[model samples]
Target: MRLTDFTELMRNEFGTMASDSMLRDHVLSDLGNRTGAVAIEEGVDPREVWLALCRDFDVPRDRWYLHPS
Candidate 1:
């Protein structure tokens, strides 16, 4: 998926508190190795690997720590 799509997905899934830096760090720290492996094995973009993760995890695109009142 595109970066915009991924960004939107992350915003929804992890909430507004989850900044892009946080997401990048989390992905690198948690899924970097596995994602790299999968990307290499599947010949897909690393970004796609991350997208698959969000999709597989059923992460919402609008997850919020606190719903607006």
Candidate 2:
């Protein structure tokens, strides 16, 4: 999904607190780790990142671009 969509999902899932930069990073790290996407190299795929976050956070699968395992 697009960055905008990801941000919106964050807001929807976490409310206004999601916009906090530090909290955002914490969330990313938590989700990234769960999907083994922690490397986060330059060539990392956005779809994979989105999938990781969605799966890790239990964000309704229907709202995600990729239904992560």
Candidate 3:
């Protein structure tokens, strides 16, 4: 799961919009608080971030593999 994959997940769920960036930023920031390791600072695993997002938002498990690439 790359950043592009994560962003694509956001687009798939939320549709295309500039607000997607804000949503991503907000989620990532909150993730840092919850995990105690900022992704950018320590290079968090993308799969971990994705799983955390899914758990935090209750996203459907079916969509978990919807990442395009």
User: CA shift at 66, candidate 2, in angstroms?
Assistant: 5.2
Model 2, 1-69: lDDT tens per residue?
454555565566657565334233544553434322232343445465655666666778777644232
Best by TM-score, which number? 3
Candidate maximizing lDDT: 3
* Lowest-sum lDDT 10-residue window in model 2: 34-43
User: Which pairs, if any, clash in model 2?
Assistant: none
Q: What is every candidate's alpha-carbon RMSD to the true fold?
A: 8.8, 5.4, 4.4
Give Cα-based local distance difference scores for all models: 0.48, 0.51, 0.59
What is candidate 3's lDDT per residue for 1-69, written digit by digit as tens?
567777676667657673254344545545656431255346776666766766666778997774433
Question: Model 3 off-target regions past 4 Å?
Answer: 16-37, 66-69
Q: Estimate candidate 1's alpha-carbon lDDT, on a 0 to 1 scale.
A: 0.48
Clashes of each: 6, 0, 0
**Candidate 2, 5: how far from true, in Å?**
6.2
Residue 56 alpha-carbon offset, candidate 2, angstroms: 0.8
